[model samples]
Target chain A: MVNWQLYLLMFLPLAFVIVFNYVPMYGLLMAFQNFDPILGIWHSQWVGFQNFQQWFHNYQFWPLIKNTIALQLFGLVVGFPVPIILAIMLHEVANDKIRRFMQTVLYAPYFISTVVIVGMLFIFVDPQTGLVNHLIVSLGGKPIFFMASPRWFRPLYVFSGVWQGAGFGTILYLAALTGVSPDLLDAALIDGASRMRRIWHISLPTIRPIVIIMLIWSIGDIMAVGPDKAYLMQTPLNLSASQIIPTYVYETGLLNAQYSFGAVVGLFNSVINSVLLIIVNFIAKRLTETSIF
Target chain B: MEWIRKLPKRSTKGDMVFDIVNLGLLLIVCLIVLYPLYFVLIASFSDPTQVNLGHVWLWTRHFTLEGYKVLFATGSIWRGFVNSLLYCALSVAISVPLTIMAAYPLSRKDFVGRHVITVILTVTLLFSGGLIPTYMLVRSLGMVNTIWALILPGAVGAWNIIVARTFFQTSIPNELLEAAKMDGCSDIRFLIQIVIPLSKPMIAVMTLWVVVGQWNSYFPAMIYLNNTSLYPLQLVLYQILVQNQSSIGITSSPESMAAQQHLAELIQYTAIIVSTIPLLVLYPFLQKYFVKGVTVGSLKG
Candidate 1:
């Protein structure tokens, strides 16, 4: 109630954010320095854009960028619509109990840890013993080593991601759909409008702002493909296709202790993300007249 | 069945087609989502050799408890499980309270600088200091390899704060605050006695989000803590899954080696089940809250 009491309440959490989040922005300066942990951030020698230049010239740069963008586009194409589709189909289900049952079943996977999902991938795709390969071998087909092969990398990563995330995404869309006023749908039904026609005309229109916001949100994070799963899935065999910017940053900075180079790569990754968010938000606002900002 | 028959006889042919197609598509989706989990459960019970040989399908063949025996025999699994439990419980305790504190003040209309603070917090979501620097900062804090490292850096999330704040603002009306203030009740007392009781649903939802998140978390553990004893279940599972050859510690006795390999395969399935069972058990009870979780406090899109 009082200003001082309010200030006290806000203190620690604000301090936590400032220290954990903003202080790291200060650490971004390490990208421009030949950062030595021994020398510390302040004492480290500044190298300006040299690390950035080296990264740009590196052979892995193009592949890393290409792989990252490709994965995002792939996800946007396939993963984005999946929940929308799920929500719509679930909406169409006339039986309430059946709709709820299917949703509960689907939401189960969303809570499965990313590590577990990849672990599931391992068991399902093991060349000699996995289920898919086993099925293939039984059907008189060659067993493909899905994990070890470079070509299968993106497909495995993206599809497994969709499998894990689509159910969770359906929640918000379903919320939006269920929140839609029934009067509109009832009017359409009385007019002899077919289910498909009503959905196309009413349901889709009602959720378009949400769809745009979600789309823009996903686009804004295009540069932030967490290296966790890809890093987990990475092996020498699949390195060519699986190597993306985040993993590269992890390896260069932490594994190899190339802190400056890692920082350079990280800064580059973040800059691209910020720029993309701005551009996408601008485009979304122009087209949809609704933006998160 | 009766409900279907009760529908009007004039129901369109297109609607029939739509129902059939929709049901069919939904069934496929359910199968795709469910079969892998089903396979894991069945495989965990089956003989490791049967599983490794690709002989088990549709049902458990050579059913055995050998995988569970081996997994329980491993000391690291128990240690990791305990460590994970501690991390999860403590982190939620720390985080939920902090999120409430941060959220409450921001929810207040009279709180000066709320806009600036929100913008600063929101900007952190869009751009962060990148992983390396953040890691460096953690290391400098002398938190590397400490439980504090796991708990401190992410004690509260800004998004959670926003959600909680939204809940507080909408649900705890300004008039209630005014009435409490008129009675000379201190802000802390009012919050503790009134705001918290009314905000239980939001708190519960946020707790579910944080608990599940903390339970499943391994990345920070992977980076910050190197001690084997400190490893959470997921990190330990990561070892068993990704780099199992070492984690299994293959011995050189040929007979023992052959048996260990067979056991190792089934143990893999057991590890996944054992680690995830707590979450799976909690899911049914918490699921209703998750719906409330997504819908509430989220400024309706």
Candidate 2:
């Protein structure tokens, strides 16, 4: 018999998702309207495509797109392979104690919150007395103002992400790697294969599907580059390098109280993510015979 | 000599080289990962003057708790600590159970509507109304600046529900569930009595995730809450670190301005450490659970 009690159990969570998640989708009509907060969504004049037109025609649109894509690509390029390499090296460790110790040490930073990590960055890269600046000065160079400079923003953001996240990223890949049969490794060794050769042939192939899956997900996630850290790091000085789509919406909609225009920009971001996800999944299906949906 | 000889021997010179190089790389990475935290630890305790001079390194120079004393002396920090605890506790209490309930049905093999529900839910991951609409909805409910605004909107995460569902499906097997069903148990009873006990490890992982997530989150607070009394520790941290609210160490004398400035820097380090203490203490015990969670969760796609 089908259990109605299970339906009863799922009731609140389903209600939560419908209210918090799906109802918001229905409210996306504000993106099409000239929304006045006091006038509210229903009473707001529905000026078809006017909000989108404003956002698309805005001078900030292309730069926001470029910055978003550039930052994600930079992160993908640097941050993606680090955990894979780390896991491989970890997988290679003959000594279990050292392997576990390295894993424990590496994963610790992942526990540190983003705000704290950024705080650490502020303290460590302080132009006058920061650790980075101290070394720079000791080496007979000028102590660079890291947080103030626009040119350094993406590098600082992406690399700090790697530092914070790479260790934890290894867990998934490492889990996948554990599925490689010991018999295959034994066979490779018996064939007088070098350790590198075995890793390249056996280990690499075993993990390729997961790698492809992660790459596709990262590509799809380009538009959803969270505004939190970027918002925190933005200075009037670095707005050129730092203003991404999320922050732009937050500034326009929330901060400047341009709710409709903000929704238009934010809706653009969501659509781009959806499109990229579908496109990437299509490419993945064709190229790798792997797809999430 | 015996211990040295007991070490795992490599079959080839190439393997030996790889081991040595691997160990070296791991050591450098460990140092790189660890040094910033170590510096913060020492710097919090070191003399503010020495710290400002960039002389504080591996150990505290003229150790003192002045930074912490100054940090804790503020009324806001204590208020933030208690508020954060409340938010974190409420959030986990609500979210973990919601996640489990959603997961239980989705995990069922014979639940005909589960696929439709899942596909509907998964679409939210790819695209949605985005920020303004969500904020507007929260506002519509008169939830702005309320604790419920923080707790309710984020209480049920679809992705985590999927992860927990997968854990239930794979780990707790259909056969086990069928056996329970045959024993004259109602679905609610089966859940509370049987499934809940069996899912302890997953629940523990889910609890840790929800708690850490709630503790770390401030963006929601920034958007929703205007009241200072409602400020969580992370929001307080945003003030200290990003806003650089060095007003806490503002000068009593212009003559001691430099001293005040240095103490301000020291206080920043202390504030980061203080805000992070719950996490740092709980992390070691919980690290294994994260690995397990990630491993299990990533099995979704």
lDDT of 2 at A287: 76
DockQ of each: 0.70, 0.69
What does TM-score give for chain A of every model?
0.96, 0.95
TM-score of 2: 0.96
lDDT of 2 by residue, A131-175 (tens): 899999999999998888889999999999999999888998888
Query: Which residue pairs does candidate 2 place in steric collision?
Result: none
Model 2's C-alpha root-mean-square deviation from the true structure amounts to 1.9
- Candidate 2, residues B1-301: lDDT per residue as tens digits? 2311133333676766766777788889999998888888889999977986878887899999988988878777778889989998999989999998999999887776998889877887777888999999999999998999989998998889988998888877677778987887788888888888988888889999888888888899899999989998888888888777755645578768867776777788898888877787897787777788887787564
Q: Please, what is the whole-model Cα lDDT of each candidate in the order they appear?
A: 0.86, 0.85
